[model samples]
Target: MPINLFKKSHSRQGAERSLYLAYYFRTPTPTNPVRYHTALVVLPSPSPIPLAAAAATCAEPQSDESESLPAPTQSSPTRARSPGRATSPLPYVTTATKFHAFNVPVNENGRGRVTWEFRVERDDPGAPNTPLRLRLVCLLFIGPLSQNVGDHKLEKILKKTNVEAKYMDEFPKYYCTNWMYEALQLLVDEKIIDPLPCSPPDFWEVGGQYADRWMAENHLQVPYDLPIPCCDRAGVALATPMGPVEEKCPDDETNGNALPN
Candidate 1:
C-alpha cells in the first residue's frame, strides 16, 4: 500500500486538512484501465491535535543513525496507532485494495464494467488488539446487452489462473464467480494481509443512495439515467469533481489527469 500525507493551508482561514488512501485497480481492455477506490475510516472534526503539539512531534530528536529506534510501547494521548508499525496524529488511517473487470463487447455496441473494493479500518488506535473493521463495496454497470458480461469475464479470469480450481470445494454459496470473494481468497494466500473475517459487511446496495446524497449536498446535478455509482460517503470529501461523460475517460492514460495518491 502507498501512503501520502498533505495539508492545504489558507492565509485567511487557517489550514484546511484532508487525508485519504487511493487504491488502484486494473482490467483487460483496449486501453489501460485504472480505477481509484478510496474509503475514509476515521475523521476527527475540529482537528485532533494542536498545531504546536504537531510541530513538537515533528521536531522530536532522533537517536543516532547506528542505533535502531524502539517500537512504541504505549499509545500517545494525541496520536493514533495504525495497523502495522505506523502512528499518526491525524484522524485518517486506513488501507484498501481494488479489482476491476471489463466486459468485452461480444455483439453489443457498448461495454459493461464491474469493480470490487476491500477496505480495512483501524477504528480504535488506542486499542491495538481490537479487530480491524472491514467492508466490501461493489459497483456494476450494465451496457446495452442484458447478459451479465462482468460476471462472465470474472469467471474466465479465475478459471484461467486456476484460482477457482483450488477453491472449488469452498466456493461461495451466493455467487460462485463473485469478484470480491475470489479477490479476498487471493489476498489471504499472501501472508502480508491477515486477520480478515470470513465475511465483511457489503455496502453495494447503499452505494447509490450515498452517491445521490453527496451530489445533492455538493450542489452537483445527478445524471438522468447513469448506472455508475458516483461517490461513496466514506470518501466523499476526497472524491474527484464530476464532469461531462464526453470529457471523462478513466482508461485513457494520456488524459493528463493523474489519480490522487
Candidate 2:
C-alpha cells in the first residue's frame, strides 16, 4: 500500500502537469531506515521531457544502479547524456520494488519509458514478514491522465499523520494513480498484505513494520505461487533479467495498450 499520490500541476502550466506516486515503505537498508521510495512517477505532459531532467526531479535515492543517482542541479538538472543523444520532452519512469529498482529506463529520444505492453509479476521469497515484490516487465513509458476523487478522499486520513504536504501533492493524476492502485490491489486481493488493512495509504506508511508484526503473529510465509499478470506483444517478448541494455529504442511504443499487451 503506502500508495500515496502527490500532484504538482505545472505551477504555471496546468495542462503540463506531473503526478508522483509516493511510496513509503521500510526496507532492511540502514541508510534508508524508513524507506520513503517513490515507486512510480507519472509525468504525462503534452510533450516529452529529457529523461535526465526527469530523473533529476526526484530527490529520493535511485535504487536502480545499485548506487545513488547524482543530485539534480539548477544549471544541469540531471546527469548529462553522452554525445549524439538529443534531449526533449520526457515520459514516465516507474521504479518498481527494490529487487530491480528501475526495470526500464526512460527513452532518451522516445516519448516515454514504458508502454501498455508490459507484464507485472509478484515475486515472493517465501519468507515470513517478507512482502512480495512488484516487477514491471516492459521498458517503455505509460502516461496518466485525470484525477480520482474517491482515492483523493481516502488519502485524507493520512493528513493526521506527520507525512508532509510536499510529500502528498496532486500528482500521479487519475491514470497513474489508478494504475498503481490496481497493482497494489493485486497484492491485497492476493492476501499478501492481509491481517492488515491494505486499502489506505496510511496503512502502508508503516506497512513494512505491520507486515513484520503480522508475520510474527501468524507465522505466515510469502507464497511463491501468486497469481501474477503477464502479457505478450509481437516483436517484443518479455525481457529477461539481462537483455535490452540500452536506453534508446528504435521503434517507440510509448502510446501502447491500456492494459497488458
Candidate 3:
C-alpha cells in the first residue's frame, strides 16, 4: 500500500482499493469448502504485483495458451443490492483483511427470494507481528436510522465482509450490520468512485466513474455487483411444464428431469 494514497483526493480509491487488496493476501487459509460465489465478489481491480511493494508493479499481463484457464464464477447466498456510488457510508478497513458473509434467499422455494454476494478488502498487509486481525461489528444504530430514512430496503441480516473475515466470528463471537455504503463513502472522499445513475426500476443506482480504475490498473474485469447484470432474461421466468397428476410418464425411466431414486 502506498502511503500517499491516504490523501483526501484518493479516498474514493479506498473502496476500489479494498477489493483489489485481497489478491495480494494469503489468509490463514480456510478448511471449509471455500464457497464459490464468494470468489466473484470483486475487490477493486488491481495490477498483479509481485510480493514486494518495491517490485515493479506490472499491469496484469495477457495469458499464454499453455496456462490452464481461470476457474468459473460461483454464486453465494450472502449478497446485497449495491446502492449507487457513495450516497451512504461504507466501512473502511485500515489494516490487512478479507471479510465474507453467507446470505440465503428470503424464500427457500418462494419466488421473490434473493441471495446476494458481498465482500470488502483491506488496504494494508500486516507483518507477522500483528498477524492481521478481524472483528465482529454491528449496528445498534440502524433501527433509529431506518425510522428517519423511511427506507427498509435492507434485507434481513445485512452483514458485510471480505473473504478472510468470513469466519472470524465463529472463532470468537461474530455478527455485523456493516453495509456497503460505508465502503462507498471512503471512495467518494478519495475520488476513485463517483456516484452514477441508479438503473431503471431501482430506487438507487450504484456505480462509479473510476470503479473500473482498479481493474484497469490491474488488467482485469471490474468487479460486479451481486445478482450480476445479465442481458439474457430468457429462462429466468420460463415456467416448468406440468406432468399429469397420478399418471406415469411415458418415458419416466429414461427421462432425467423426472424425479430420481
Candidate 4:
C-alpha cells in the first residue's frame, strides 16, 4: 500500500531530499498472531542540505482521508500506547514523510495471525534530491500477544531479522522516536537489556528539551526513563450496565452511602 504526505517546511524550501524506508516482520506460520509495534525516528544527518532541497521541490497527491491520526493517551494491548515523532540527536527532518505500518493476519478460517510491516517513502520518486537515509532500530516489548518477552518463540523471531551486528549482541545504545517508558521497564525485567545508555549531561539537557517539546506538540512519548507529568484524573469511573459492577470503595462504607459514594 502507498501513503502520501505533503512537505511544508519553509526553511528547507531551497534544499532537495527524499527518503525511503521499508521495515517488516515475519512469522513461522500464518496462524501465529502477535501484537507488534514499530517506530521510525529521523535523526540529524551530518549534512541535510540536499534533503531540504528535495523536500522543497517535491509535490505529491494527498490521501482522500488526509487527516493525521490522534495521539495515544493511554495504554492498550492491541496498539501502541504512545506514538512516535520526527526528531533526534541531530537536526530533525522538517519535511513531512508519508509513513505507515500494517499488521496483517493471514488465516484460512478467518482467524488470522498478525505480522508487522512499516514503510516510508518520499513524495517524489523521480526527484533529484538527496536520498533520506538513517538508522533502523528494534526493541522487544511486552504486549498482550507478546507477553512472554524471553520466550524461545520471540528469540527465534528476532534472529530471523537481518539486523546489524551490534543489535544482536548488546542493548540498543541509541535513541527512540516516540516511546512508552513502561515498556522499557518490562524489557529490563525480562533481562533483555541493562540501563539505557546515557548521553552527557549537557547533551541530554538539549536533546531532552527538544524531544519533550516535539513530543508534547506532536502528542507522543519516548520509551525512556524520563518522567512525564501525569494527567489529572477525572475521578469518575465509567461502566456499562452489562459490565461488571464497580468495586465499592472503603469510603463508601464509612460514609454509609451507596452508588460508589
lDDT values, one for every candidate: 0.24, 0.25, 0.21, 0.23
- Local accuracy of candidate 3 as per-residue lDDT tens digits, 1-261: 111110111011121222211111111224322111111122221221111121122212222344322221223232332222211222222233343343333544454443333533332221111211111100000001112211122211223223233333243222121223343333334443333122111101111111122222332221222111110011010000110112222432222121100
Q: Give the number of the best model, judged by lDDT.
A: 2
Give the clash total for candidate 2.
Answer: 18
The C-alpha stretches of model 4 lying farther than 4 A from their native spots are: 1-15, 18-101, 118-210, 216-261
Model 3, global lDDT: 0.21
RMSD of candidate 3 to the true fold?
Answer: 21.7
Off by over 4 Å in 1: 1-98, 107-177, 197-261
Provide TM-scores for the models.
0.24, 0.20, 0.19, 0.21
Candidate 2 vs. true structure, TM-score: 0.20
Q: Candidate 1 at 94: error in angstroms?
A: 19
Worst 10 residues of 2 by lDDT: 227-236
- lDDT string for model 2 (1-261, tens) is 121011111111223332223232223343223333323323233233112222212222122333222221223333222211212222223222221122132453764443221222232211112222222221211222235422233233222222121111232122222334454444334332222222434333332332333233321221122111110111111111111112323432223222121
Tell me the deviation in Å of residue 191 in model 3.
Answer: 22
User: Any idea how many clashes model 3 has?
Assistant: 38
The model with the greater lDDT, 1 or 4, is 1
